[model samples]
Target chain A: MARLPPSSGPASPAPAPVACSPHGRFGPYGGRYVPETLVEPLEELTAAWLAARSDLAFQAELSDLLANYAGRPTPLYFARRWTQQAGGARVYLKREDLLHTGAHKINNCLGQALLARRMGKQRLIAETGAGQHGVATATVAALLGLECVVYMGREDMARQALNVARMRLLGAEVRGVAAGSQTLKDAINEAMRDWVTDCQRSHYLLGSALGPHPYPAMVREFHACIGREARAQILQAEGRLPAEVIACVGGGSNAIGIFSGFLADAGVRLTGVEAGGRGPQLGEHAARFAGGSPGVLQGTFSYILQDAAGQIAATHSVSAGLDYAAIGPEHAALRDEGRAEYVACGDADALAACRFLATTEGIIPALESAHAVAEARRRAPRHGADAAIIVNISGRGDKDMEILSRELGLGGAADSPVD
Target chain B: MPSDSRAHSSSPAATPAAAGFAPFFARARAAGRPALIPYITAGDPTLEASRAIALALAEAGADIIELGIPFSDPVADGPVIQRASERALRQGVTLEHVLALAAEIRRRSPVGLLLFGYVNPFLRLGWGRFAQAAAAAGVQGVLATDLIPEEAAEYRQALAQRGLEPVFLAAPTSPDARLAAIAAASRGFLYAVSRTGVTGAREQVPPGARDLVARIRRHTTLPIALGFGLSTATQVEEVGRFADGAVVGTALVAAVHAAVQRDGPGAAAPAAAKFLRSLRG
Candidate 1:
């Protein structure tokens, strides 16, 4: 309920190349806050990434894969009907949901998978919450013929059953993690444990732009294509840059990716939607920007929901994808610098948005992406009718079909109990 | 609480000197053996049982004790120690409880005591408050598994002010510069990870461990303790040949877990002590 600070005017020049911290810091927000055991591996990874960035062969191969295999340059569609419904700003949907894995996660997974092969790693491990990342990692691992394993919370596995099945069918072993809150954070812990035990032969394909150094930066670069394509596409369609850009923030990979493309445009406002499950009460939401404090979780220093004793607090959201206690480190830095504003969309608002989009635009959005839709809808009326708003539709809603059916009381008509 | 009258002393033992680890390493050097450091979660089964286990390990010739403050997410720990932490957390153990337990152990034992865990809990307690509490509890030092030297400036200052040594870890994969930084930042001893993995017992010490210790030796003369997969007496003796100490954690905690599974909480201390004795041989 406190007064929010005024947005700082865009500085003279664009922010120093997105997330270029020599020591892996995003203005005192990110650092390699990991055990000594991981320091060497992280350094080696950083060195390898630096080398690969300049190597034309590496870039060529990754580009080919992104274009031919994972389907690059996802469409930027103007949702004319939805824009009219909002009665103000023109709305454009950056259709990352149409990617091969039904989400934007494949972008980073494909890149990391290639890097792992370059590093001569024989196996890949990852953690997932809504199962999108797990499926993406599994798809890449299958294509590369590398042994793959994914850790998912037992609760998430049950909620996102379709994604679980997809991951398993792709030949990645799914390990159910039942520890702590049994969500993305716990799965990450289990994956880190696995990585530590098998660091010599295993690559931890971190899905989000979070965790220790190099990861926040690496994942963002891989997902940056979303922003790059959207920026160009929006310019061609509307003949100018959009007035605002929006995306949902879980671990903030998608938001960071899109934001990276437009960080220099001071005229455009950047907004990130967080999961406000029920309200502002503790344990009821995953709005780290609202309630979290600066602390270390997993490996990076970021805004994390924690109790007085510093123990991480459990988070809740209707969408499993956004049910995390921490956001990415770069997002934290962006918030600190007032370059981006984070708002919360509760479960009801997101669900309504999801339903409205399905009916109006004939597009179904992942519950996570629906949060961004809800926020864009709220802000659209405040802007001029000619103003344009671009929202990153990060994933399709296939994985949430069952949950949606149950929540909407539309279950029990699809299949028999035996099947 | 145990009926041991010494544990009830209104005035706790005097806080150890800033160079608390010096005497232990010197004693081990004179005795022609590596210092044996045993680790256990502070409230594994119960706070009282953890206290009894620490006392028992000290009695069985442990040179130092690393009490793990149970955390919800311990990324550096393998399943053995991870389960130990989970059990402790399930019993409502917190950083406050661990500090109080350290005071109890300090009242009855002379072995060096080091608080070990992740950084968040300590940060949650606030650096200054946690440092003061640790000093008052007679804790000799602290080693946060995830607090790298790069981000350890404030933490190092807090610990130094309280005379609590700040222990840092040096990994097998460390480059020369990082090795030097770790060595320079370390106070009590430098923990040399035997492999590029989390903590657990292994049959054979990773071949890289010896070289890691040698690399650390180039940086400083600080006592180096090799750990992360040392479970057997043979492995302990192997590390003793080169390093200043051998840390045995998962194996000892596993031993306690097995005993507790078979004989309930009362058997934890005896089982841990027996395991420590076996390692000493």
Candidate 2:
């Protein structure tokens, strides 16, 4: 169990350091599985991250940027109506949607951008699926005055055209990848290839907690503020920790961020909601925990949806942000240890939750977050009315309005009124 | 795991050191010249046509023939090889098909065969099963493009158990410690990446490559084969001055692609043979 400091008392001594296996393995899940060409760069990144972690100046600068630039300490809202609608638990929503760039991705991008600058890298390259990370990366690049390039799958670019325009508007070049499934995985492949060629001058700002070492650990630490703030705020508001914490998992950045706060809290339950897509059939969903096996992809060993021959299988989800074939390595470790539980919500359930949140709470949740909302809706009714649940509303739905409009048959009116 | 011990542990009939490109390197050393190694995507235009192209290159002067097992996602490859892989995948080529093709090629030619591809397909087939099947198919060695030496202990053990060489790559950016580790782990020959980029052709070999080879030579006596961006004969000759072998992949693959477009798949063998001859000179 985690030792918590009293609200009125002086800060307690730091808790005992969590134990991890050498070489960044989370119970045999994560390792450096890249080519020889990338091993040195990964080592460089690992050393830089270790040095930065202890440097007070680096932490102070990052804190300053998070507060002044990306907007830190986003509010924690009490969802009275949502609680009443669920007819059980008292629900709270962590308002990460209020952050700059409209999602939690900026937290990581800003930290990596600062690291890149410190490393004397003049260029930044990233890969995105739903364009939220791309926009966040581009925004930080523009702020830092560094050259930026973002690779998006052609299929994703078509679905998220507004984000493409936003990236270009931010002075970042947007390249459309047309290989493989033409989705997040292919974009990752292209971006890695570019990094292998241009790593001398460029920093590959991985957007999630799913790649090789130092990235999963580094990105998690950058976003740990989300959990840290929420824990303190919730304790102040409710006088104790919530009964459960829930967040949607794609490559599992947001969930990992929130989970980090309560990982040692024995009283808090962690639930990760994955995109179930249409159903449970193969190629119909991105529910990695449901159908995936242990395999390696993009430099990390994790649960991956692959065919019998070990080729990565295609995955689908209405939420572009959650449409991936694998989850974070730590999540796999957490699941195995019974520390965290993973579940899935179908596309229809997610969309219904998105609509419900819009009409009831007047808050349009991103489709990715809607999966969490849907899971909360299902689980809340089973708990007592006094029980508390916190759902991480990871991003705003403005970027997803186009897809929602097309799906809901609202036509171009959805795009016309948003801007 | 010295070379002699590894040779002694495997099947008594199979000389593990002689089964791979070591003999070719020795022969080239005797001839006082660098060996020419050519790479081609298996089942590029078609599997049968790829077989003919491999034999023709070997007959023309290729000391070691590298048959690329086409993968859907090849991050280490540039546009040329990427397109070739896509074309081969479209032809429904699998690892099984590539192994079969290697078996047929071994029957017709004595040239050394190296099966090249990413790690997923091989992992799918199971490393033990894949290594056994590969050695039985007469494959001399295996170069998994994405499998680094650090995470390749089990893979190397399996290959060593089967008397098949486990080849590892060394990049210019590799530190001295890593170079020593790679040299100790790599069998057959050390694949020295000519530059810090994906496999493709360039006008001039990166100047850093020569220094990298010199650094690697201090670590191990294993013959080093320089690859990535060696397209022209002048570049090949320049590499010959310092390295034991020069690997030509993208240029020969481009020739095969051009031949298929111009005179059909039948012309690819002749075009590839002509290109190999020119590079050897």
lDDT by residue (tens digit), candidate 2, A235-334? 8778888999999999999999989989989989999999999999879999999989888888888898987767788999998899999899999999
Which predicted model would earn the best DockQ?
1
Global lDDT of each candidate: 0.88, 0.87
Q: What is the TM-score of chain A alone in each candidate?
A: 0.94, 0.94
Name the runs in model 1 displaced over 4 angstroms.
A1-18, A414-419, B1-13
Q: Write the per-residue lDDT of candidate 1 for residues B34-126, one digit (tens) a residue.
A: 889999998998999999999899888888899999988888888899899989988889999999999888888767898998999999888
What 10-residue stretch in candidate 2 chain A is worst by lDDT? A1-10
What digit string (tens of lDDT, one per residue) describes model 2 on residues B90-182? Answer: 877889999999988877777778999888788889899999889888888999988888888899999999889988999987999999999
State which docking tier applies to candidate 1.
medium
User: After TM-score superposition, what is the CA distance of residue A410 in candidate 1 from its true location, in Å?
Assistant: 2.2
